[model samples]
Target: MTEIQDRPAAPLATATFESLSPITGDVVGIHPVHTAEEVEAAVARARDAATWWAGLSYDARATHLSTWKGVITRRLAQLADLMHQETGKPHGDAMLEAALAIDHLAWAGGHAEKVLKRRRVPSGLLMANQAASVEYRPLGVVGVIGPWNYPVFTPMGSIGYALAAGNAVVFKPSEYTPGVGEWLARTFQETVGRPVLQVVTGFGDTGAALCRAGVDKVAFTGSTATGKRVMAACAENLVPVIIEAGGKDAVIVDADADLEAAADATLWGACSNAGQTCAGVERVYVHDRVYDQFMSVLTEKARDLHADASPGSQMGPITMPRQMDVIRSHIQDALDRGGRAVVGGLDAVGERFVQPTILVDVPEDSLAVQEETFGPTVTVARVRDMEEAIARTNATRYGLGSTVFSKSRGMEIAERIRSGMTAINGIISFAAIPSLPFGGVGDSGFGRIHGPDGLREFTYAKAIARQRFKPAMALTSFGRTAKADQQLATIMTMLHGRGTTIPKD
Candidate 1:
């Protein structure tokens, strides 16, 4: 085993933890339980590495990132397999997740220079004599707390972008998938020949340590409850944080939607990766005219899907065993509230897997509809029209991602839904697009981690205004006269004294 160098000296107890394969509950790897002091040391080393990284020219950084990207792309299968073993996701789903992450890496590397380089800004009439420009500078070091579900893809959203923006990253992956995180760091080290990216493995205490380790910024992805805790920890140091939290995402079906296509997308969105996705479709609203037909098609499609570790399975076991109880509770609550399970019910949630479950006529206030089940379950509800559909979709405290299926009103309805990203006639397609930003609002958490905004998230804007010529009125100087002040006041009034009005009124 190639141990990560610079690990803090072990204490007397020398505690450790094991990463277990969710599929078989076998030990995948054993790692030390890094303490707060160790996490702080890692960040301190990252601070030094960040200086060297940020000092490199944009082309130099891009070249290095490109090399790392090529290494990951060529060995995509190897990484995907690790993702599968750690998260218990199907191999094909792991591949898709890794591929999307690779694409984002490429985009972040190729566009960092263009996005962060200094550029001139309009000085406006107030500062016309000054030449003003703004550029993004890398924050010294960034701390990343990753989620187990979609381990590789989710963390890379922050890691890749942060590196592209010229910052070193210290990542603390979820305990359930520490092996995957270690593999990433090892590969990155091999490609870059430096500790520009490092991993510290442990549980929640390790994550909280990273937040308080004096990093310039922290990017966290997990549940909303955990996100709040992460934010509170970061608050101790007044460190900035970008939180990608949980969501109760929905899919809205319009009367004019392609019923077949909508049903297919809804089933896949709700059951893919065993529906552990934070932005997965948990609640679906269909127009009353097509509700029955859509439900029939969805139920039939879901019936064909199964969650298991067996070969060629459509889904896999829940990465976290505790989530099984949550899934069962939601199903039971829905049933107790007079809802009927169209496909699978409470029994669908087995020891490690949650089968495809579709509930109908679930009350709007039911936990199945109001909370994130984080399992392969969805509640189908009827709406009188698109108006009600939009209203119901926006009723949740979480606004992460949503989907819409309509022929003419797809974009229109999507616009009305309050979410960070909305896919029309597609399922979670925005995540694969490199130019579009990904994040959420309200309880889903705030801050983006992809696209140009993602690059800037790990950086601070530095603005410079040089005096190109002396102003006619030296308003800012002690030499300014009362006459000049009067003239400036008159100009200000002339520019903004009048408010425009409608002629007809």
Candidate 2:
């Protein structure tokens, strides 16, 4: 039996919080700080809904998800505008994010039946008389705690897959992006004609309540420190969890690489979304042979980029205002520690936006290099070779996404990086592929949130073995004679008498 947390009775709620726009600090929307009791009630409702939803055939569930996909795709612009207002990202970026999420939804719905359906398996020689099979069953209800960055694409990694696997979901969006969460649930309800997906919005306490709300599984995407807390909360109920946490991702530029393309991809990966991306490039290690040329190109391209909440802005304001201080501290620490800023530095961080800041010659131990400076800032370091580049890149506690820009050895170098996803000759493109599983290792969190692994993450595997015929050798019954036991031993010896030896590759 699974152990449950000792949850205290939640008091009635009379409090509320407002989602403010990060750009102008204007109120985007108001929502309640749902109590533990309210969250559990929502879970209870989801549990009931899950039974009916799970009872449907995979094709039936796929149909519903497809319908929801159409609804979201049709209103892509509307949702993107809402996302822009709440998160302060450019409309085009928001649309791209939403479109990618929609694509994932389609993939999850279209492939779930083939991926999760029961299938037969060989029973092996020892159990030749039995027929074996396995199938993945829904875990009933799932709780997702989403991050503010890439609000749509990130959370849907779990949400879309969980629903396609036949579980009802209750999502808790970040305090800064609750409206986006509400809009998603509302649209899903509109298409499905049921509250299969629900939203609970508020601050940290509200999210904590969701953690203790007795859901079967929890999918959390946020900072590493918060991921630890979420893991602890989920431990109370022995519930399974998937955490997509912080990253200090790096980009490697080999001597033989396309220097211009490498610099362009790295800059975009680092500065796009105001550098709020978890998988965004925060570090770059270039081979010493071409370090000078790479830096020259990177600096020139970065100088042309800017962050603003106004129209025509390629980058927008930081979604979370508190992040400004963190970004400023990192830049200041880097500069004070003998690092050189080629483009923007301490002055780049403003009231709401952080301009593209490029730091070069920063110590590997510097906070800007080690920690997740989730603003549009990146630290570039020189390395002697690809070996040193891989070593330096893997030295961080984070093991999320990484990039390699080598014409011949991109995949070879990427394979050596201790990260979950690696982009070859590109930047953060793994998230765009719906078939790829996305997550991280070590401090970056565990379990996956996309593809077949994601569909299975919110489910339990049920295995069955049926006896097809009676075996000639009866090993389980007392009716077995001494001669029968001897014969069985003789047969076992005949099959395993050979000594074990290592095979030469």
Candidate 3:
């Protein structure tokens, strides 16, 4: 999913990469392609800063994070403009992404104390003389390797929560959107007066180096293949990592569902960001009773929308250039496998943009259905019943996000799907809530981000056991007498004798 890749470092002080605008193929900016040495240096600085940052009280940290959030909120349009240039998503979409991320930042800062602060626990009868307590402690420095699609929102799910939990972060943004990463670091530096949030720009080497640079944890967002590599790199140090990778998210429509509402949500979820969303709807399983009506409404609305760089276009160009080939290939394969294009077909995929494409009768084994297209295309299939729909939805190896649209059985069906999160009657609503965790199971990758889970991801649990008084049993002392042993046997027998099983021949 990333455009830039690993290359040998130049002999100069620093090598660099050009960020290209998907709309015009023009160079938007040039950023340094940091080497392994530079990544290590950044981690060293972050490790030092983490000590000072973690020393501050939770309320103090919240205040500072709020200031940075205010800065981002005030300059939302500016960040959105950069996002549109690098990612080529619509201005409004870019704004919305950054806005949601900012809200998460605010929530992380405001709720860290309540979610992470130490608390007391009851001691058991045998250990009544002991007091037990537990709290989450910060893991020094965190490395974040962000994805190009939804660059701001995706990485901030890690960066924001990690900081709120009292850790310094070193972010390695996707080579495609390095400027946005630098902008965030620059602003945080000005507001917080430290390098608590820093940026390292480069390609795959930069990210791989970040993982080996001795950070406490690494949070990554991208393809499932790349996620495995990240896991391997961190294995040497046993560094805990959270991977927010791609998904072939599906939507299930029951016989009792609202066809019009379902169609509108499906189209938006599929084509909104030109289908680069990691959790965008890629497959639909509709009950046979409402299949025709749902398809009729979906295709009609899809026809009215288009992808282009032209002003006021609802959809924007594909951010990564190579992804266009993948998009087109999927469409062609679906058509070759006896799928009917009820809407735009292969002709819909252009050099930089892809119009909405809806396929009917697509085989479940086809690439368009089995893999992550990451394009503005969807496959619709008719199911015999709601049970069949649920089975088909859970068939994919990816289990990230899913949608269930049913008036009476929405919750029931949603819970049945094997995904990290599900939207009962909405599209991607779990991501916006900030309290529900976002992630995947199986091939979609592991670990979670967002909510209390996210705040705790960059931390480790520390437990405390305090002895309040001497135990009457003196179990650990060699001075125990025969009477003590008899008493212990009596206590055990009294507790479990009635439940013991006996066999008499």
Listed in order, each prediction's TM-score against the native is 0.96, 0.95, 0.96
Q: What is candidate 3's local distance difference test score?
A: 0.90
Is candidate 1 or 2 superior in lDDT? 1
Tell me which residue pairs clash in candidate 3. Answer: none
Q: lDDT values of the candidates?
A: 0.89, 0.88, 0.90
Mark the regions of model 3 whose C-alpha exceeds 4 Å error after superposition: 1-14, 478-486, 493-505
The alpha-carbon deviation from the true structure for residue 297 of candidate 1, after best TM-score superposition, in angstroms, is 1.0
Off by over 4 Å in 2: 1-14, 499-505
lDDT tens readout by residue for model 1, 1-505: 0011112334547689777887899988888889999999999999999999999998899899889888888999999888888888989999999999999999999999999999998887777899999999999899998888888999999999999999999999888888889988998999888789999988777888899999999999988777888889999989999999889999999998999999999988889988989889999999999998998888888888888779799899888877777889999999998999989998888888888999988899999988899998999999999999999999999999999999998988988889999999999999999888999999898999999999999999999999999999999889989999999989877766775632230
Tens-digit lDDT track of model 2 for 1-505:
0011112223455467777787888998887877778888999999989999999998999999999899999999999988998889999999999999999999999999889999998886667899999999999999999888888999999999999999999999887788899999999999887768999876677778888998999999988887888888889989888988889999999999999999999999998888889999999999999999999999999988888766999998987766788899999999999999999999898888888999987888999999988999999999999999999999999999999999999989999999999999988989999899999999998999899998999899999999999987888899998988998888777666665743232
Pairs that clash in candidate 1: none
- Where's the lowest-lDDT run of ten residues in candidate 1? 1-10
lDDT at 367, model 3: 96
Candidate 2 whole-model C-alpha lDDT, 0 to 1:
0.88
Candidate 1 wrong stretches, greater than 4 Å: 1-14, 500-505
Can you give the lDDT of residue 292 in candidate 1?
87
